[model samples]
Target: MTATALTMLNCHLTIPALYFRGINDMYVRHSRIQHGVGQGSFHSATVEFSATGRHRFDYVFDCGALKYAKLSPEFQYALKRVSLTKRAPGGNKAVLDLMVLSHFDADHMNGAQSLVKRYAVDRIVLPYLGVEELALIIASQADAIDKDTLKELHGLANGVGKLWKRPVTMVKTGPRKTEERVFSDDPQREPPDAERSEPPRTQEFPHPVSVVLESTGAAPGTVMLDEDNLVVGSSSAGRHDTWKLRFWNRGLHATLGEPGIWQDFERHYKRELPQTQTVVVPHHGAAPNAGARFYNPGLNHRPRVNAVISYAVRNSHGHPHPSVLADIAYAGGRLLRVTDDTRLGYQEIYLFRP
Candidate 1:
């Protein structure tokens, strides 16, 4: 169906988003952190995908770490203040349809375990890159972490799999690209290749759950946008059409051999990409993630897109990079920052109507 048709369904959809403020610390420096105070770009969003009101999807993207602490009281309080729970049918705690970890950076995944413990997460999504490969990439970057924190982050990543009994899906892009595969029970063991995968372990949820992966193709170096399935139906059980909602994560830096995020995304999913109205600003609005080329209206244009950048107040690195902000404005998109100055703490960006 056309986006115009979807606009007719806008009254039937409500998108509520919560962006958390990261604890600021002066010590660590990495490309992910534009300024001295690193940003915790934690986002929890809920999408009511079906008109039946039976197909609601909740997702958490990159649970950011609290400053100087693993489970900081401030962070916990924020979670509670937001009423983030797994309770069914009315408890404020959201029953997550999916939990996505963009990369292995501590800032990206530090609070993952806390989320698992607090919410009913049905699936976890990881990049196609292996843990070791991701770890090495972080090591090569500037402002590399010490051995202890690295170990701790790795441990926490592993813990998410162990703590959640549901499926863990890993996604990658390229010619060797594979369909989303659900991992076996053992979190430590290597999962079988996607082509040779087995059935996922059974999950008993209060509602039906579906995960959708939008990829360019099986070509080498493609981009895959992963998220919960988006369905269009006048009623929840009526004939449904599926759509995509892309969440861009700054996973790897561009190298001589690697394609840039937007480049790969454009090459593979350009037709579908433009249809996306909402996007999470990559790398907490870092410059590299929002290069001019990505937002150039003439080249890669998205008409009337809403871009959300999660930044901390008074962060060391001035985020929502000035240039990126200009580019976003140039593309005719509204820019929303998660910090208090902007829209923070349980705000509704889109509401469904009949």
Candidate 2:
């Protein structure tokens, strides 16, 4: 009878130095707009991640997309995530669940109006536009904030659009055209190669999760959203079902296109698949949709998989790239970089560690 427990809430990521906060308003308006309205037409940007409290998470990056010219502070780092509604142990968060704001810049919606002053949100997934082009990019960032932070970023985007008023599955995770699988020893063709030939099955699209909450519930009301699409840290009842919990987050490469984002992540990894051994990587390690590969050709011959990078470490973009960590270490996977020890940070919990 041995059971150990330790739960901490604080998964943050922030990077607010984008070209030194807009490089002195662009060289002091470059000579008052040198000849008129100029200074390279303003491009000052920043913002990476945030949740701040009630589980914690924050990040915002900027430094001229970095080619290098002064970036110390250990190149900025932070991580911590563990809390997805009630109890403990992975799996479940799909009451239509999703929170993907993949691209819209600003390091991906940094402090995104603190998600309506901070969580309780239902749905807000996005890949592109629909609602008047996302309200003209939130009215050009409320004309560069300042009317009381643009009235508190429009009253926190209208209380996070009424808890992200469910129904924003504007899916988009394209870039399908990746066909390169061959591992056969051919005993004379058709079906005699049992030691090889296992990488030819693809086609499943529609991933646009920014926020979802429709769980009516066998278990996902406290917010553990299930049906398999994991988001853990704390959730129980004795934990261990829904096949060891699962979660994905790499949708929208450019928007409902690009071969339809690899046919919507090959149909959610071919219907709730990912033999749980722990997983987490989808854009935080950056690399466009491939966002740090996690290839698992059914673990053909098994015994390998070490991916858990959530980004933060000299992140002037060059994110976890080493060719996306050498293509997830050439498919056997093994990257692990939640900033690789920020003294303690990286919480997206739910590990009853069965």
Candidate 3:
């Protein structure tokens, strides 16, 4: 082995080094908080992780608004930026790893149909509703929103209708407890004909990504979401980091004025609230949805929370209520209002492993 032979070996070694760059650091590249029009909501985040190899998981929470006939600008822009498939090999149809539709409000999900058409979503997460709850949602908003949106809501209540092309997780809340159940629209997955003896068809992306609920003392478990359990902290794992997101959605029947929702939320963490880097203000910062419990950083110290309020400039509901704004300020949260206007631009938050 001479000097030339050694130099040739080093050149080959550097080729593999290019592929392993940043392979150890698992972090969120950035989250795009969409400035939706007329009280819509769209927030997406890209997480880079290493499993067998480096991979990226993209997820979106709520994409739509109260646009009458046409799709909103922000939602359109979001679609433009979102990739058509998962950021890995095989070229699967699934675009997002997870899609969370908080509730059935028109403003929050008016463009859902468009989303379904544009991207093949992997799994959708929404609150589970009974007949009464579904009826309340339809009857309550019958006159306020368009009929198409109402029809779509009706479809989701029954079985996610056209959107049923993908998998779904329905989160049901009980007395101070929450349960999640998985439902599949694909007959191969959950065959409609139970009597059939044939095996299910093979899936391009067979294994779906799961939300792991974590607690202080307990190790997180991958949720099949088919059992009775209380999942407080939902997290997605990277190679060296685990990112957590806590969603607080007061059920349609829950009283908004009081703090029961917050109480139930806190109880999950054993009364010790963890440090939340970002908090999406619920209901576009509607007054009823805002409570002091949401702002508390608790014993675990944290930097300024990013309080994101997605609403329109002149919304009929007057969202981002003065009190909600004030409460966020008092809690030392960095108020980041996301409206239809481009003034605030895309509020991108970068997350790194602690």
TM-score, every prediction: 0.58, 0.22, 0.64
Q: Candidate 3 residues 1-354, lDDT tens each? A: 000000000000000000011224333343454554556776565555433233455667666766554456766776676653543322554466666676666666667667766666766666665567678876765665566655655676676553446555565543443432222212123211321232322242222233333222132222212122222111222212333333333456443334664455445333124433455565667664443322232311244756667777876676767876776776677777777775333456454432
In model 1, which range of ten residues has the least summed lDDT? 4-13
Query: Over the stretch 177-252, how does candidate 2's per-residue lDDT look in tens digits?
Result: 3322122212123321321233321221111111112121122322221122222211111111111122223422
- Point out the higher-scoring one by TM-score: 1 or 3: 3
- Candidate 3: pairs in clash: none
Candidate order by lDDT, decreasing, is 3, 1, 2
Candidate of highest lDDT: 3
After superposition, which runs of candidate 3 have C-alpha atoms over 4 Å from their true positions?
1-32, 68-70, 84-94, 143-162, 174-250, 255-257, 269-272, 288-303, 343-345
Q: Please give the distance, in angstroms, between residue 273's alpha carbon in candidate 1 and its true position after superposition.
A: 2.4
lDDT of prediction 1: 0.42
**How does candidate 1 fare on TM-score?**
0.58
In angstroms, how far off is 354's CA in candidate 1? 11
How would you encode candidate 1's per-residue C-alpha lDDT over 1-354 as one tens digit per residue? Answer: 122111100000111121111111201110111111235646555544433223445666566544553433434544554333344532555676667666656666666776776777766656645466546756663253555545543543454332244456544433414333222212133312431233322232323434433221111111243322222111222212222333323335432112454354444333445445555565555554543322333222555666656666655656667876877787787766665333233244443222
Candidate 2, after superposition: displacement of residue 159 in Å? 3.3
